[model samples]
Target: MKKIILSLLVLVLAASCQEQQKIAFVDNGQVIEDYQMKIDMEAKFKKQDEAYKRKTDSIGQAYQLDAQQTQLKLSSLSQKKQQEGSQQFSQKWQLIQQQLQYEQQQMEQAFSKEMDSVIKSVNKFVEGYGEKNGYTFILGKNAAGSVMFGKEEKDISEAVTKAINDDYNGKDSKEDATETTEKEEDK
Candidate 1:
């Protein structure tokens, strides 16, 4: 009876000592905002947006100049010529407006798609991170509150962000090295 009770106690203790499933939560917004890749991508997009704006402004200014010139000459022309010129100007202006609208829409769609891809990439990285780290579950807490109340100790946003940035920096360094090697070879 003593031996059986001792053995049972040991078994219970061993079972109690078994590792529990690890769980963590990441603040998705915090992680993405601190991510270096996202910052760089946003800067690139901003530059592109500025360039597009400049191009559109140039086109708009040229159209405006042409329209103003047409308006100035309208009063001096015969009524028929004035009517024809006005009609031509209106058609050209409409065409330019439509083109600008289409270009703006395309630019917006492209930016939206790129942003979506970046977000997806971030989410994928987090998923892989959880898998590699042996986390049984990694919940995301965003504005929508997928994770309502995770303990502060279990929030891995900073660690995950650092890991992601380090990974990004490593890839950038590798790319830079490759580019340098190619240039040296060309020389």
Candidate 2:
């Protein structure tokens, strides 16, 4: 009917005239870089890497000592026996080298896996933050240019970074909200 069509048009117009969505953006790189968890993880991995280096160095020293003794024994060996001893020593060295390479790769893989977890946590936190704060849309601006341009005022990257760090430090979001409200009231 004409009346039904008119009513639908009126409703649509009213909805369209309502306030726009609450949208904002964050710098993806900055948020991840400034996150305390990532920093802590990096430090942890660095310490582990240094310890690994020390351990490998010790293993090499021990191997060199043993190799020297083997060399001395080989020197007193018959020519044919010396050649066999050298071949066996060479094969052992190759095995050691392979083991070291494999261990190094494993450590690298572990590091990568941990970093991936950190990144996922950050993204999940950001999603929860946007939902809890009544955001209609929250864009992430990364190097790939997902967001071409955004107003500086709408860039909530710093607040988000601080919030995430506070969360990492075991500080609640409610406390942060209360503090922000109090600051605004004082102002």
Candidate 3:
């Protein structure tokens, strides 16, 4: 029984000595914010929003003009006729409002879907980065607080952000090639 216990202890010691787990965590919010794709997408969405506003404003101005002209025409009519005309204009305005609302909703949905895709791509990139670097684990720290506390040295958010931005800008492969060239020159 003693010998068996010694053997178990030896096995545990050997396993412990084999390798240390390499863990790191990234501030997901910072990484996403620095990602070039996200920045570009945000700019694109902003422009789209502005364009929508301009178009709507133009439509609104046209509607206002029509309403003014309509009121002028109705002023010459009888009271009953004026009431019916007012109702018709009100219905037309309601339709315009609904149309504007629907367009805005559609724009919002498209922006949301695009952003979700961006997030998925970023996740995939991080997974690949971890695997390529032989990391045992790469955790994320986000608004939800997946990681409550980690050593500052273990916080690799900056590195991850740089790597991701490099990848986004298509510089990762180029940098890898440059490193290989430098290695050959050293040899």
Candidate 4:
């Protein structure tokens, strides 16, 4: 009877000793805001987007000018020449439209590729951080949506964001206080 009791006790203690790992989920949307590399990537993307927009707008304006010139040339042509010119202009316009579409698709793919790279970097960083910090799991949330059903304790969004920002900013509490003092003196 004592042997059986000891066996049971040992089993219970062993089972209890196997710690259940803690898992946490962070709203990666917020984390991205504090992630410096992600911020730099976004800034680069914005500049590329603006440049693409300007190029597309220039192409559109060129197309409009060509159309206006075609209209004028058509009026000055003989009826037969007008028909031929119009047909040629229509074919050229169609080709230009196709080219524009291809360019837009290329731009979109490039942007998507850049965004994917940024996301992958962020994911790798988060995974390494979680492992180092003893988090069994870390889940990313959609930036466009809200977390409707996570347990409050498991939602480490704020902690993750704060930690990331604090690390990224590189200004510890003491540095921040000193900076504040300097600013006050300057004022």
Identify the candidate with maximal lDDT: 2
Please identify model 1 stretches exceeding 4 Å from their true place: 1-18, 171-187
Q: Over all chains combined, what TM-score does candidate 1 have?
A: 0.76
What are the clashing pairs of model 4? none
- Looking at model 1, residue 123 earns an lDDT score of 92
lDDT for each candidate structure: 0.80, 0.86, 0.84, 0.71
Total clashes, candidate 1?
A: 0
lDDT of 2: 0.86
Local error of candidate 2 at residue 41 (angstroms):
1.3
Model 4 weakest lDDT span, ten residues long: 176-185
State candidate 4's TM-score: 0.68
TM-score of each: 0.76, 0.80, 0.86, 0.68
lDDT of 3 by residue, 57-155 (tens): 999899999999999999999999999999999999899899999999999999999999889988998898777766788899988989999887777
lDDT per residue as tens, model 4, 6-59: 999999999999977756677877777667767776788788778878887898
Q: List the residue pairs that clash in candidate 2.
A: none
RMSD of 1: 9.9
Candidate number of the best TM-score: 3
lDDT score at residue 137, model 2, on the 0-100 scale: 87
42 in model 3: Cα distance from truth in Å?
0.5
